[model samples]
Target: MGSCASGTQVPKSTLRSGSRNPPFSTRPDLNLNTPWARSRSSWREEEPVTKPSRKLVGKCFCGAVRYEVADEFVYAANCHCSNCRRTTGSAFKPFAGIEREKFRLTTGDDRLLIFGEESGHDAHCGHCGSLLYSVVREGAYVHVAMGTLVDDPSIRPTAHIFVGSKAKWFTVTDDLPQYKGHVT
Candidate 1:
């Protein structure tokens, strides 16, 4: 994680807000690692600028890293996988997938260092060591780290992945759905 003494603030209008919890699960899951079936170029060119369904704010531990999500998350998920737990040092990781173009770094880009793992990349503040967001794959979408955000993601875990390797201390109660390993 990166560290910094100061942070920047972005306007709130960039994101959307809603209280109703959105569904995070999908009936027919898609492979997360594979390229999005939709053409990237076409999506970028034609993607509508919809208002952010939820407002989410995040910063690094040292206040150096700051960011805002300006669009409603397409999906929010919880992972109990060993790698996620180990990397986050938490029982579970709550993440929201938003379009990469919608994510904005309000400040502290210099402090942001990306640690790429086999599963995903951890984006954090290099100065304060605050974990910001994880980019599962570059140029696709961002997995907003639920813990790092200042505002509630306002979404629920659609499914729990890697349940077979989940730690003993943690238990998922959402009941949305459970996958022993990768669902998509």
Candidate 2:
């Protein structure tokens, strides 16, 4: 029995079938003893392996809207702007920025409602009024509400934006960088 690259043990039955070529078998015409073949095998063994990207799931409070992100976030931030606070009903909103192409509405897409201008809009679950994300930069990116995330993104807020409009009653105690206005 031999193991595959994924460490799965292959049954001996499969290997002895004689219908398929055995693992590590090169072209019959190519001399396995040649330097070229040895170099090819060594190169194959040294090839870098990569893990598949993780998929993150998120949903509204009422579960009326569910979505998935194919990969990790491009960036994360805490927005202290009044608009975010008003929409989220919180002092600050932590969001993860992801490319639009990576975000997919897995379920309840029809239940989503968009508010605000065409250039930027806040998406929420129409059934529960749960804020999901804010589409900005002409829809190139989505600012996903971290609170709505059902899975850990493995990324945390690194900065605070729009601090000038932050609530006076709240104080940011973290050492993260803060920008008076939006970070350009």
Candidate 3:
């Protein structure tokens, strides 16, 4: 008996008698069979999908130290610097950069040892003396030892850093970008 906002006269027959809810029209233009007409429960049943959380895990050689990173890496690089070579005992240190917040120590927090000053530190497992990661850029990034990773990050080293300090015995075979010093 009342008119809708569109100025169409809402016939009393359109509404169910004694019902407080709005009128349910039988108009063809309403298309009540469409997806928009389905109830919330019905809509969910039609499409059910869930995304799994992504986690990249790593551990020390002796498994004394374990850590995990969520989502994606910030960057990856093979550092040929003397410091990395000396610490890792390798020709080059393949490392991946991750945000500090996303990096978590799952265990062996007490057994973790830090070398160097607060400005820069190489974190390792005290028990097995396994180099885990280096806290660099004033603690803004964690340079994870790629060798320690148990899961693939799906990212490859973009460049070779500090090639000037690369060991003479080792030769870089890849065509990745090389930097004489650290990449800015």
The lDDT of each candidate is 0.72, 0.87, 0.86
Worst 10 residues of 3 by lDDT: 20-29
lDDT by residue (tens digit), candidate 1, 37-127? 4566567879898763565678766788889896478888778888788778888787888888788999988877788863567887888
Q: Report the lDDT tens digits of candidate 3 across residue range 58-93.
A: 999899899998757889999999999988999999
Estimate candidate 3's RMSD in Å. Answer: 7.7
Per-residue lDDT tens digits for candidate 2, residues 78-174, read 9999999999999999999988888999999899898977668999899999999999999789999999999988999999999999999999999
Candidate 1 residue spans exceeding 4 A from truth: 1-55, 117-120
Clashing residue pairs in candidate 3, if any?
Answer: none
Candidate 3 runs further than 4 Å off? 1-53
List the candidates' TM-scores in order. Answer: 0.64, 0.77, 0.73
Model 1 whole-model lDDT (C-alpha atoms):
0.72
Residue 164 shift from truth in candidate 2, angstroms:
1.1
